[model samples]
Target chain A: MNAHDLIKEAIAEKGKFDSVYWIACGGSMIDLIPAHELLQREATTFTSYIYTAREFDIMRPRRLGEKSLVIACSHSGNTPEVVEGCEIALAAGATVIAQTDNAGSKIDSGKWTTWVYPWGEGVPQAEVPAGISLSLAAELLDQQEGYVDLADMYAGIAEMDKILPPAREKVNAELGDRFAKLCQEHEFFYILGSGPNFSQTYGFAICSLMEMQWQHCSYIHSAEYFHGPFEATQDGVFYFLQMGSSECRAMDERALAFLKTHTDTLMVLDAKEYGMEAVPASVRAYLDPVLFYAMNCELRAARGKVFDHDPDFRRYMGVVEY
Target chain B: MNAHDLIKEAIAEKGKFDSVYWIACGGSMIDLIPAHELLQREATTFTSYIYTAREFDIMRPRRLGEKSLVIACSHSGNTPEVVEGCEIALAAGATVIAQTDNAGSKIDSGKWTTWVYPWGEGVPQAEVPAGISLSLAAELLDQQEGYVDLADMYAGIAEMDKILPPAREKVNAELGDRFAKLCQEHEFFYILGSGPNFSQTYGFAICSLMEMQWQHCSYIHSAEYFHGPFEATQDGVFYFLQMGSSECRAMDERALAFLKTHTDTLMVLDAKEYGMEAVPASVRAYLDPVLFYAMNCELRAARGKVFDHDPDFRRYMGVVEY
Candidate 1:
């Protein structure tokens, strides 16, 4: 089955269950947040548990009577913590599902049910696995709002595809050199997302990890920025604000104003000014910002491969087992 | 005035009012959290609003009341945000009390009431003002708790004074080098706390903005970690877990075990291991952790200054309002 159908089926199955708990680490868990919100709004308590897979065995909540469904994700199924978590949850009498790139890997080796996806030979490196997996899990959890209609999501992806050549040119030709120059001295990034784009911020953060670059990113409410943290924004702070929604218009303006006054290194993607307005609102929320993120991932990967020659490269680092 | 007397006078004068809202940035806000808990326990809903000074005017909550109190804090008395918040609160019909340092800064300039402390040149720059302000605020809001034989608190602080210096030496001597080295490449830190320390984690996270060096630092409950974000620890995500009580002890252990398998960097501070046994068991619930926190603050500041400094540092570049 295609990725979309698989997710829809999972969501349908999850909807049939009375209680659902999602457990995953930072990178994979973020994709589930949007759907988790939908579940909560639908009156499903929808608790999210984020732990190291190894901790899963000890921290698993006790109420595992038949109705609970546990969904775990790891791009590589070999992570030790995830493996341990599955063993503990199954022993505790809860049904477990493993979502991974390699279906036959050890992550799905035990009593846990498994979902697998194809990523071709592109090394499954970069952003695709996480995006697909999270989008799938979100669907399984029945979390898609009207905002992510399947047709529109695909169309949005298509829209992003169209912009890729020019966007790449604009970013590489102008922004890339600037980013590379800045990143050389700066070891961190603070990515801010507003409205629906916050999910993209979470996703973008995860991809950074996948690319094997150590960078910090935060997903904050635009409105909350005016609180004290704004004071911390200095020359070293790189602020990435999503300039799409009217609800967050004030936040974008405030961030713009702060960067104008307080700090010097401000990497902003003024989506409106960039002619990115052609993308539909719903899909663009998930897709457009990623265009910038994709470039970031490429830059970092090239940096690591060409510049750093990180010894841990290429060898999958083979999933971490708890 | 002595800390105890200053608080008593402030509370006595401010208590006559119908409501109180503690306004502050991160560290400044934490001093009031414990007291707020006491007040909230007493069923006093003071409409607490925590925001940056600039946003205070923009996102100010509903007018607290004609007799409401706005307790504003700034260690320097010069932090632009607190000064602005004080102005806004005073203009909004709320009584403004400035908990700050020195006599001449803008935060202390207007019709607002001011509680100033003599600068402690002996203490570290960022902390001296904060410690005094926090101690005073704590004493003020919980005068009953503060003076309920503060001879014990004095002893506790004194004992803490003795214990922390050595403990800081021990942790720094043993783990400091490792942490500094790890931090050089691993840029993200996810800190976890549970139960009473949940708010403590929140406050500590605010203080961590210093070390974040623009990295993302997030703190969540131990229980919540298992649900969604746990899946991301495939290659062993780095994390810090704060173990406060026996209840959350398992979670801490689980985290350590998981980190052992999954992520590259992990630090777990278990109070049981920290010789907190010297603290009176009766008050250990609060004193042990609070005292440890006092040390953590010291250690973090030392570490930030020593290792986390951006070679080139600048402030307030993101966006700010005057």
Candidate 2:
């Protein structure tokens, strides 16, 4: 079934839901963030949350029951924690929608509905994990509370299919060499982002930079940077800012202005600079994270070439058990 | 009014509420996290969230209305962002309970209710910001969905009043010199914690270590460390784990065990090792963060004395305009 149909069926089976939970781990969890942010910003009838799968399984929120809708993702569909979370949600009689790139894996063993998206080359933008999750959220919001810009959000997703490739190429051509140089020069960095875009900032810092390249980094919310993290700013410190095209842009701009003045080693990737005018303004904020995700992948690849470290190399991750 | 009485009055005036938002910034924001976690874990009738004041003010959730309850804190009560959030909540017709150390400050200028907690020496444990916030959450849970362990929670708070002073003294005597030495030896550290204790982990890393002492640090959720951040863990890297006495303690222990193998420079502050045996097991987890907060203050002070950097010293906080 399509994403919308799956959401509609889930709602039909449950009758109504007062809460929605997005559960996953690592980059999968990060991919679900913008969708959770959508519900947080728009849905008045229901509350939503993003949880790391292991924490969700351990904490076991008391609200996870028949009236709850849980949307979970695991790239391999085999992450033990996410699979366990799906089982728990199913046991609570919640409507569970499991999204995965791997079909017929452990996650598919559950009684919940499954949506499989393509993982490799030439895949449609909407077929990616983030796109599918956002579509599910938008569909649920529309079915439950009537999202006014649901059509526009779909249009934004379509526009992404056309714009993201060029956008990634542009990022590689414009910022790749500089990013690679910076990676070579700095041993550590502070990444700043706000609103939905902070998910990409975190993914790029922890999953890409730290996990892939073994770089030390910290991701700070643009607004919260002013509170305490900004105190660590100085001439020698490195800062990378991901500027968003949303209501929270003010916070990002504030951080950018401060970083520009305080540090010489500051880099910024502003979504507005990329060609996103084809996307609707109403849905542009939600799409900013998608664009940044593509750009981050390009930048990571560039850094990998310069450092001679494969972005896919892992020291412990599938290689050894914790 | 007392914290519980204030919550009761707010609910009485509102008639009913489906959501609660805890809004603040910096340490004030961190202090509210345990309360937010309490609702997330126990209250099935209502949903709750923690938001940085600026983000809450800007994003302005559509759910903030007559059926919404907002509890905000600002240490001095004049934090512009939090004051703005209180005003926004009031304007939306949401019931607002504003907690502050300074009673007559700007937050009190709103039509919302205000609860004043003492800030200085000899303050009872239950009269502090974290304690008051937790009490408000517990009261709301008890009134809304009947929290079974409400009395035990209060008893735990009373027990804290007796145990915390000696706990702080013990932390200073046992770990002070070693922590100071580590601070001098290491230029950066990763602070790890899970469940509600992660709030203290974040508060210590960002607010105390980085903001006050100009140290570089990143706060990693213990469960999340295995996902990506663990790849950056190695022998020369420093790690400080805050072990909780709760369901999520398993995650902390997992991270601790892995860190012990991967890095020689690791420190752990385990709540179970302290004198928390007298606190009810059911409520002990909720108070773990409180104990860790006090312990962190002691450790920060020890480092401060070693480096001669006053814990209150700030390069930018109130000194410069952002």
Candidate 3:
């Protein structure tokens, strides 16, 4: 079933929900952020939260009961913490919507509504985990409390499918080699982003740069830049700033202006410079993270080639037990 | 007025509130986190959130109306974004509780309820910004929805006043020189903490190390360490882990075990090892951040002496305009 239909069915079955929780780990947790942000921005009657799976299990929020709706994701569908969280939610009589790329895994158990989204080569933009989660969030918001921009958000998702592929290629052709060269030259980096696009900033810092490339990095919120992290800004430091087209864009603009004067090695990936203009202005900010995610993936792939290290290679994860 | 009396008066004036927002920037923002976490963990009817002041102003949550209580802080009481946030909250018909160390500053205007907390030498633990915020949160939760641990939390606060001074001095006497040496040897470090203690980890990395000492750093959530940042752990890397006596202690323990195996330079400050045994176990977890904060201040002061960089010194903060 499609994301919207699945969410509709869940709402219909549950009758009412006072809270929605997005639970996952690592990249999966990061992927659900835009959806959580959407609910935070749009939902009035209902509250939303994003939790690292294990912490959710340990904290066991008192509000996680019959009136709660949990949307959890695990790409492998067997992440122990996520599966446990699904079980915890189910035991609490909360409706659970589980999304995964791998089917028939532990998380695919028929106890909850299971969503299998496309992954790997040639996957449409709307079929990715983030897309499915976002669509579900928009639908839930529309059904629960009328979202005026619901139609625009749907159109934006469709526009992403058409524009993201070419945008990724264009970014690769224009800046891939330069980004790769910078990656080779610098061993550490500070990444900045705000609003929904912070998911991309965080994901790139942790998953791609630190985990995949074995580099050290810190991801700072653009809004918090002037507060403390900006003091670390100076020449000879590597910085990558992700500029989004959102209300929070002012925060990014301020950080960009400061970085321009302070740092010589600053790389900026602005969503507006890409093909995001085709997306509806009402929903453009929500889709900015999707554009940033695709661009980062392409750039990271280039860095992998330059450094002679496969992005998929890991020394500790999966190979060692904790 | 005392925090509890002020919160009670505000609740009486407002009649009812369904949500609480803690908004501030930099260390002030970090200080509010424990209170927000306390509400998240204990409050059943009221939802809680922490937001950077500018982001809160830009993304004005739809829920910020008559049914909302906003607790905002700015140390100097003249932070532009925080002052603006208080105005926005007041305009939205929300009860605004403004906390600051300074009097008669913009944030101290009589438009909203202003709270002046103690700062500088020999301030009582219960009168600090974080202590007041946490007390306000506890009082609100107790009066609104019956927090069973309210009395115990108060007891914990009083215990903190009796214990924190000596605890800070002991930590300094025991680990000061070594921590300073580590700071001088390593230019970049990873600080890890879980649950409420994550506030100290973040505040130390951004405020003390990066902002004041001009060192590079990343603050990783203990729960998220294994997810991605663990790959960056190696022999030469420096790591400081804060272990708390909370349900989320398991997360910190796991990270500690792995860090011990991978890194040669690791410093750990466990709340259990400190003099927190005197505090009631029921409220010990909530007060762990307080202990960590005090210990961090002492250690950072030692590092400041060694590096000849005053913790109060800033390169850009008040020196330049954004």
TM-score for chain A, candidates 1 onward in order: 0.70, 0.98, 0.98
Q: Comparing to the true complex, what docking class would candidate 3 get?
A: medium
Q: What count of clashes does model 2 give?
A: 0
Assess chain B of each prediction and give its TM-score.
Answer: 0.72, 0.97, 0.97
- Candidate 1 ranges with C-alpha deviation above 4 Å: A2-15, A37-56, A62-65, A91-95, A120-166, A187-189, A194-211, A214-226, A236-253, A271-279, A282-293, A305-322, B1-205, B208-270, B275-322
Candidate 3 backbone overlaps, count: 0
User: Taking the tens digit of each residue's C-alpha lDDT, what string does model 2 give over B191-241?
Assistant: 999888889988998788888788888888888887888999899888889
The interface root-mean-square deviations, each candidate in sequence, come to 8.3, 1.1, 1.1
lDDT by residue (B7-125, candidate 1, tens digit) is 56655765644455666655555555543432322222222233444445444544454556677777667766677777777777777767776678767775767877554323432
Model 3, runs deviating above 4 Å: none
Write model 2 residue lDDT over A1-322, tens digit each, in one string: 6778887887888786988989999899999999999899899887798899988998788888999999999898999999999999989988898988888999987488888788865787788888888898899899999999999999999888888888888899889999999888888788999888889988998798888888888889998887788988999798989998877799999999899999999988888888777789888778889899888889989999999999999999887779
Give the DockQ (2 decimals) of all models: 0.09, 0.80, 0.79
Residue pairs of candidate 2 with colliding backbone atoms: none
Instruction: List RMSD in Å for every model shown.
Output: 10.0, 1.4, 1.3
lDDT of 1 by residue, A213-321 (tens): 5444454445445443464566666666656432334556666766667678777766665545666664444554445455555555544554464523432233333
